[model samples]
Target: MADYYLAPDGSDSNAGSSSAPFASLQTLLSALEAGDTGYVRGGTYDESGFADGSDQHGTASAPIRLEAVDGADVVFDFGSGDTGGLRLWKCSHWEVRGFTVRNAPSYGVYVFGDSTDVTVENVTVEYSGGDPGTSGAGFHVRVSANTVLRDCVSRYNYDPSSGGGNADGFAVSQATDTVVEDCVAYGNSDDGFDLWESTGQRLSGCVAHSNGWDLDGNPAGDGNGFKLGGGDVPSGGHLVTRCVAYQNRRRGIHYNTAEVAMEVYNCTAWDNPTNFYFTAGEHVLRNNISSQGTVNIQDPVDDAWNSWTLDVGDPDFASTDPSSSKFLHLTTGSAAVDAGTDVGLDFDGDAPDLGAFETDGGQDVTSNVNPVLKAATPTGDGDLAFTAGTLHYYDGSRWVAPPVSYYDGSQYLTVSEGVQTDAGLVDGFERGDLTPYAGDLGSFNVSTDRAAEGSNALKTAGGRSAWADIRSTEKAIPHGSTFQARVYFTDAADSAILRFGVADQDNWLGAGYNSNESGIQLSESVDGSWTELGTAQMTPVTGEWMTFRVEWGVDDPDQIRIRCFDADGVELGTGTTTTSANQGNTGYGFEYTFQYGGTGPVYFDDLRIV
Candidate 1:
């Protein structure tokens, strides 16, 4: 029995049997005979408007079937451009179930190349592509290797790349033995399941939440769920079970470091703020639970506080956002209850839990230990005297800085007890007056310790500007090594430029500079007549204050060169340095502009790189 009739009032030849129904779904599956089964009599099979070499080329021992006419309800949409859905080109043993494929400007269902046994079950891919680039891809599996996507459901297939670039619910690139199990990709904005550089895959019992989309419509970049391995290192080994990634601003599972061998069982990532990061390669995580806001087990390239078996609090379930009508909102005993880990399978025996349900259990404690996680007990006898009460300063970002409207709005944001002031310069800003009182924004030194550039320095009249920018470390001048800078200018402005240098200034060693682009060989010009262009790149140094960037003025005549290259005219390397008016030809002034290139212990920072 063969019956095929698709709306818009029928009749292309009418002979697909059941009632002479034969209006070309490749001529009613080429008049089926091999494993005979053909029936497509729905109402809306527009494929947007059908014409662009209309094709539904299916073949594998004569296979072509699209059944659902006995109560009528099936659809393969094509409302715009990339050509009317159902273009499953390149031969394969196929089975495409109960249709509802909408808007395709790029790809609704496109599986190209020497295609294999492709099965797209109970399909429903909407909106395709919208915001960015063209509107394409709902079920787009390219360069196909071994495909399978079961019980699929992708809503609002947005491609916020307009010309049709960023749109993915199903975009598994460079595929291998692929398997996407029990699927349900919600509100897909950017990444719902954007698995790139593919390999043997298994994404089981899936639920990619929020799936953010609408940056152009502006929801601020919504829930980006499941973006595992970005830019290299995902060629094989797979398993990401029982998933439910909530809110998802950054992660639900984005670990692709080429470390390869992987496994993440019984998963549950709540609130999902920048979660899960690990690499020693061969990965395996049992009974997973990363709670509300930030779960980074390790990744800045290395040292993850000693890798895994982690529990950073609150996985107390019953309320980790779960409810599709199968037991949740559990407050009963709560702290994630019976906890989990069975590898044996228990419908609800209570103890194999860690995410996708399993009796809702929680708590493995993960062996405790977060006692500040060790490493920071070296006060070495303490006591550093600047003489009056107590005021010291040097907080690194690198080499003298203060230009973000100068801090009243607070640009750099980190302070764990660093930055105090006394010894001289006291006016409005710049490293000499010191501010911030911190740790961890970028650099830090006092030769190596007093916490904030010890030895003696405090200058804040606010001209060459350095609410703090410390950098140096080019040996200083070997006289046992230790430089110094202390000024308390009132500043009426006749050029207050104090700059210092050595390495990381374009990677400098000096023939006049290149330690990665230099702080301009050191400059020091204090005026309004407190008169003291200090050492101006002088000589003896191990001064080590360390904290840099915001060298005021902008270039040369007065100093301001942090990390170099801002390019308004271009030319950050070539001489013209000396000037207390050229004291001793290069002695310059103010303790040799904090000295470097002679001894060794000078890592200074707090403005002066023009």
Candidate 2:
């Protein structure tokens, strides 16, 4: 039960104290016993003289810890020839934290051979596999039980031999009671998180994105974002909750041919080529969202409240890119908000959100009710008895506290208010019909390729000429009405325009976009004389989605307010202007026009009027 120090400048024969620190990590680790703590000073520990934890052992109550001192930067540079940076072979009750290990030939940290109670936290492992002949992983744990890996990042590990056949960020094999939480893995040549032959493993609040690609952006790997199990193994009873997988080259979350009982709850999969592909597993999926992908799930599974079966819109994640550190926060108006089942989890709204990150502004009703309440003891009739967190009402015969499960399958006491429904929804395109609207020179059809809500969207293909628009049939528009719609562009059109408002051939007061210049234009036509009131830059990316909102007759009959939002629902630009008064309009709808010879297509969904 002592504390030792390791520094780069000291000698191995030193006293191993703070002042006279041991020079090498091997020396300090060799001397550590149960209840011993080694403080690594701020310096790079080259792999040439690194410590191995094969013979070191510790007890559960007095675990050995190797931690960076005072949040100092400790680097374990394994160079390119070493097989691994930190190899803990058959070690028990060891904790490693706050270290960056990189450039190992095989793995950054390897825990092998029946290791137990190993905790790795706040560590980063990168660039672990440079050898073509050997497979590598950032953090590889095999035959380890009761291991916890949290607050860690693994990225940029590859195996060049088999085109990254066996490279992963974090891999757990033959392990039991393993928990991986709050970890992120990206840019790996193979799967981000791989679990094989593991039982009773839980992964929560983890994110995996953009994996299965080499450093040169080549797709030379099998890029499943989170590969729970595979290889004809009996990996069973794994739970994955609140995890996010996005932009991986292959399926976002794949339970591939693992004949086991797996459960996934409140996970989000987005932008991957094929999201949520489960082949031969007995899976229980609840409240998960797969936004963009070909979702293929086999039989023998219980899927409930998943976004794929509901009329769900885009998840509207706060930031799709991990660089923003706001990867999966639901936007204010996201359909995923409050769309999950209440399964004894902490949630902000009436229920949990369908994704990893819940929006912040939702109300938490759990705290409003008193967990500890006093009730009158049942004496004769119509009295309530409170005991063990439950209140029972005596009906003169038996004490009953109502049915525990509500008709809708929610806990009676834990159920908050009803799920919030969107108001002023004019057309969500959920009807999957184009008869309500009319197309002029363009072709209008309902497409399932992409949508902001539901499974269908209004797809418009422009004709050979410009201004080939699609307009609504005959919807009345009142003064001071606000209109909004989500638009998705399949490709770049130099001169595409999407408009919504009271419109006809001559008298039109609406808002539109000038795609050639990437600007939003608010215009009104008075007796066929079109006047452009204002313009603002809102260059949307090609093949991306954006929201457009307009308020007509605000403050005055001629005043207009225009706003635009990116996919994340962040206001990109806004403008307000006053044009000539023209308030006598009866027809309202949307109009989209594309020029570039009608080569590209645009989708519109979630049209609302308020």
Candidate 3:
């Protein structure tokens, strides 16, 4: 039994022993259905979490391979176990080259795969485990088909859940014509390469950075150091080119709704809290190079920093300063080199600049999503099915509930670009951070900390901002949910909480516990004169960001529907109530806080909730 044995041979280590080979790769998969081309010649083979070879061995025509001697580098170490490192279940024409599959608890080479035509080149899946409850991942390809993950290199991988959850370096699910080329997903917490419910996939010259943004809390937000997208459906042609995502928490190249003929060329994204968070599919982004913060495109140009056919500066890469001196440099008379625009760019020779620093002269905020008269937030939960008009609905358990955004107004208008004015004289501009800047779209004129110091319209409050604040978590939102805000009530009594529901469940103040403890049963009354007095229905939790709506059918979850519209969409109050979610009833939980004060003027949009 001597094909080339070594592991302390007592013999029959499946006959490939000069020594005593075959120490368990399932004893060479029980000697692979009766050998055809067996060669574990060199040694060290234990790729367990590598999907324990999912369906076990294969034969599209006698296809069972494991190489490393044509140029030796084989090193399957999987020291810990629970999942993948080598699993190719119903394998076909399988091929693994110049091996080095590390730590294998999760993935180093897992193609549990069916009908497999796998070919993993120059592979290297390192340090898996980024802590969001820790499950381990460096390569998790599900529903595999026509797979090819080339030139790999997955690094650090540590986000078990600081705010973010889990880690990923390469995830292509529901695969089809898949191709991941010239890869490199660094630090890893989330997307370094992710294409969900995959179809025709293609990623070229890839590069992902510090990686990981725990979202829902705004872990950092941004996906595309290669992140195609999914969930709201859509997703067909997946293609990403010349990539480079720096600081990495958001967009270096991203798509949300499944995405269609997706395309992002000559890429380079900056500090990336958000360097472009796209959702509209059938996508196409021309020559890219975006700089320091914000580039959310929906295609409605007015000022992406400097108005452009292409060309919005500063991506002198090699340094966003991760220290060593520099880390994202590319500056030298930069306007993104020569400014972009060669369209669908052909592997850069020149002409290309939109995002991912090709010499980033990037700063076309596209007007921070510019488009004022705001109120658009239904990326999904129900895929966006809102419009009851007063704020309320009940059909799940029943007990009556509807005011469709509740409002009994006198006057309110908040379709803004006009920053501080609702009369009552002053005070009203604050900056970002609330769930990543409250639905962020545009119009960011900043400051007005609390207004009143002298109140000259609160010193123009930053310059121009509609208003911002929408942060609450520790998740527990029951009863009907609908919260809309774009507001205007020009007299004085201006209020906001388009949707704040959770009528019962312990005071939601989570930093150390604060109190007034927002248990707001219901509130909506932005008076300057309109009347159903807006809504504060089923309000529970202390995290303030008012505009209201809640739908879970029935008034028990503390029943809610506090809507307020008056710009010719009138219906200020046709009330309905039944509040009590029991956090011990105690104190201020808002049976009313839609603030029914004086000076009037209000407006708000997309209040939230299916």
lDDT for 292 (candidate 2): 72
Q: lDDT for model 1, on a 0 to 1 scale?
A: 0.44
Every model's TM-score: 0.26, 0.59, 0.30
Residues 11-45 of candidate 2 have per-residue lDDT tens digits of 88898999999986678778888899999998777
Candidate 2: what lDDT? Answer: 0.72
Off by over 4 Å in 1: 1-87, 93-104, 112-135, 141-146, 149-168, 171-178, 181-202, 205-210, 215-217, 220-265, 272-290, 293-338, 343-610
* Candidate 1 lDDT trough over 10 residues, lowest sum: 404-413
The per-candidate count of clashes, in order, stands at 107, 1, 162
What local lDDT score does residue 541 receive in model 2, on the 0 to 100 scale?
56
Per-residue lDDT of candidate 3, residues 199-310 (tens digit) = 6788876667656744232353234466777754556577676666766666665676654666666665667777656756556666666677677666431223221334
User: What would the TM-score be for candidate 1 when compared with the true structure?
Assistant: 0.26
Greater TM-score among 1 and 2 belongs to 2
Write the number of the candidate with greater lDDT, choosing between 1 and 2. Answer: 2
In order, candidate lDDTs are 0.44, 0.72, 0.45
lDDT of 3 at 200: 75
Model 1 residue 428 CA deviation (Å) reads: 39
Tens digits of per-residue lDDT for model 1 on 428-502?
A: 222221212211113222221222323433322122212223322111221111122322212111112233332
